[model samples]
Target: MTTTHGAHGICLSLLSSLSLSLMAALCSHPALAAETDSAPATRTLIQAGKLFDAHTGKLRSNQTIVIEGEQIVSVGAHQDGKPGDTVIDLSNATVLPGLIDAHTHLTGEPKFGYEELGISTPRAALTGAKNARITLLAGFTSVRDVGAPAYADVALRDAIDAGDVPGPHMIASGAALGITGGHCDNNLQPYEAHAQADGIADGVEGVQKKVREVIKYGASVIKFCATGGVLSKGDDPEASQYTFDEMKALVADAHRLGRKVAAHAHGGDGIILASEAGVDSIEHGSYIDAKGIATLKKNGTYMVPTIYLNTWLLDNADKIGLPEFYLKKEKAVAAVSFKNMSNAIKAGVKIAFGTDAAVYPHGLNARQFAMYVQMGMTPAQAIQSATVNAADLLGWADQTGALDAGKWADIIAVSGDPLADITLLENVQFVMKAGAVYKNNVAK
Candidate 1:
């Protein structure tokens, strides 16, 4: 009877094993089976001699990046290259995270003397497409277009995202909100002229209405003119346009709708007011003083000092058809911008790299890096301002601005280390965005 029991137990064990196998097979039905059988294959492997780690501001040597579809699957020393994977050997170059431009006007160029002859929406959109391609080739894989005439920038951003056109990833603010006769307003007209720019909102109610309108038009960010601007006619650059209350209202409304506010502020009062009102970043803090610097630091507000614009404008003023009045303003503001930015850096204010690119030329955006370095920022810190810090300001930290596992494969390579000579970044030899290589000097 004991022998019979032992045999019966063995039979039960075998039956149990068989049942388990059947259950496993059922769980691995065709759909599940296909998933297991068809793991995603690596599409590309970037073999880099040196890779810039934007997170730590360090250079990692002899790295390989494995990519799958649009994202980086893995990045390390022993990254396995799969069969049929296209390999880009950048062993002779220094690979880094693709550059980011914090300020760009993709849709419009600065009008020189002919204020009425500004490019139409359709024409501006076409120019934007061209500029986008040039910018991508120059190695800026992402940009935060701070302002555009009307809502042209919004359409361009959508077009690039939808794959209808080739361009960098864009975080666009459709149109800058402003009070009547303020910097963002089309105040170039004579007193008798009736035309006004769309963003000319007055008082708290007017500004609030304009902010909502821009948000409805698909602005990922809200831009407002907190002070008079050099480019705008008949406004004092040092005078604050929007009152503190007005700015606070705008910031509150934008933040409530899950959007960050970018204030175009050039004066001390405007910068301080915007900072105190909790704006995300201040653009062109050209006239920022000690109090403004303290306010920015205390509030943790970022300063996007477009230092290059002043110099570029002064140099190319005539060629770009700058009006006599605007030229005078540029000359007056240029020196102040450099000094104010230098002081802001010394005062420990948060800096985000931004070049008012449309004010100069699109492809020369990287020249701003040198200016940042000159302003007491280290080369590494300057690059970081453009990459990690700018990404944080744009709310795109999780997606781009770093070379890491699971980030979008937006990267570029130069012949030499940018850390050694930051100017090398001004001429990128290779460009890749979303796992697709758009420029490669070696392959060419």
Candidate 2:
């Protein structure tokens, strides 16, 4: 009787092993594995109380936006979502297209004088990760990172794209092209150090080669310092750094490669030169004169006037630890920036919003909108500068700029009507990028 019982237990164990083997084989089949691994499609419905028509710079009431995956499927009048759809109720808020910043240096924040000497390339990349989140949460869902050391912005962009970190959609440039001892160069060190900047290139041939190199190394846009800057040591902001021939070569090479060029031009001469050379956008047009404005209009060049930093810098200069040289330059630029920018805006030279964020702070990007309104721009025009004009400059108008059906689902909301009070955008209540909600105080 005992022998019979042992044999029966062995038989039962063998049967169980055979069943498990069969199940494993079936599960390993390609079709079955795909079925098991695939997740259900996500459908999100956003009920907007008042949707800003970014395309037309108007407002439409009682709208709904449907998102599938990372793109907008449809956006129209209110409709009930089907079953299994995630619904976000922003019926009490005003929804608009996500804001864009045409100029940014995400790899570094506010730093002063000699303190910038110690921060290395790796550290800058880490700083970029932090600032990217802050910028995105502040409702800037797309940014063009104009410069960073060692191409760190490219790595940061890649990490964000791979889902390893959260950041706004980024268009990163390589090291900004400049002449030796220019603003883009490391001009602080003495003759012994031979501290050549990553972007230091002289002559037309040198700059054209530099442009190709940066593009080869993953630069989507080419940024070149066309004039001296306030922050760099031993340079005059009113002086042009790149000659017209070199600027022409740089612009030609960048355009040939299908990348836009941004020229950091503060002086009137530099602005006119850059505009005449066919640069896509002019940054920091603090000294723009009548001729420069005419050149910009003639070339259809966009002006990314980073005008808000003037107020923030003057208000917080002590905390920022600017040296006497930088402080003096800042004061000089600040004194004239508003008048020049206001004149340009009044003259109808296209303006796009940018706030040299690291020079002030990252999250305060929206402050520039108020400054734009102060500069004689209507609220709608100012908003369009950040949205439509910026997208056009970045060459991403089809993918962003407006809440259209085929665009990425980049959306934001404010508690009040921004047309009535543009400052309301400073405190964004809801933020969504690529169908993902980063901040939604309305739901909370």
lDDT of 2 at 24: 93
What are the TM-scores, per candidate, against the unseen true structure? 0.90, 0.91
lDDT of 2 by residue, 204-271 (tens): 99998999999889999999999999999999999999999999999999999899999999999999
For residue 386, model 2's alpha carbon misses the true position, in angstroms, by 1.0
True lDDT of residue 67, candidate 1: 83
**Candidate 2 lDDT score relative to the true structure:** 0.92
Q: After superposing candidate 1 on the true structure, give the runs of residues whose Cα lies further than 4 Å from its correct spot.
A: 1-40, 78-80
Tens digits of per-residue lDDT, candidate 1, 1-444, equal 334358878998789899999979977798877777777665889999988889888899999998888999888994656678888899889998888888899776666556645568788889899999989999999999988777889999999999999999999898888888888877766778786777778888888888899999999999999999888788888999998889988999999999999999998999999999999999999899899998999999999999988877877777878888788888888878898889999888888878888887788999888889998988889889988998899999999889988899998999987888999988999999998889999442
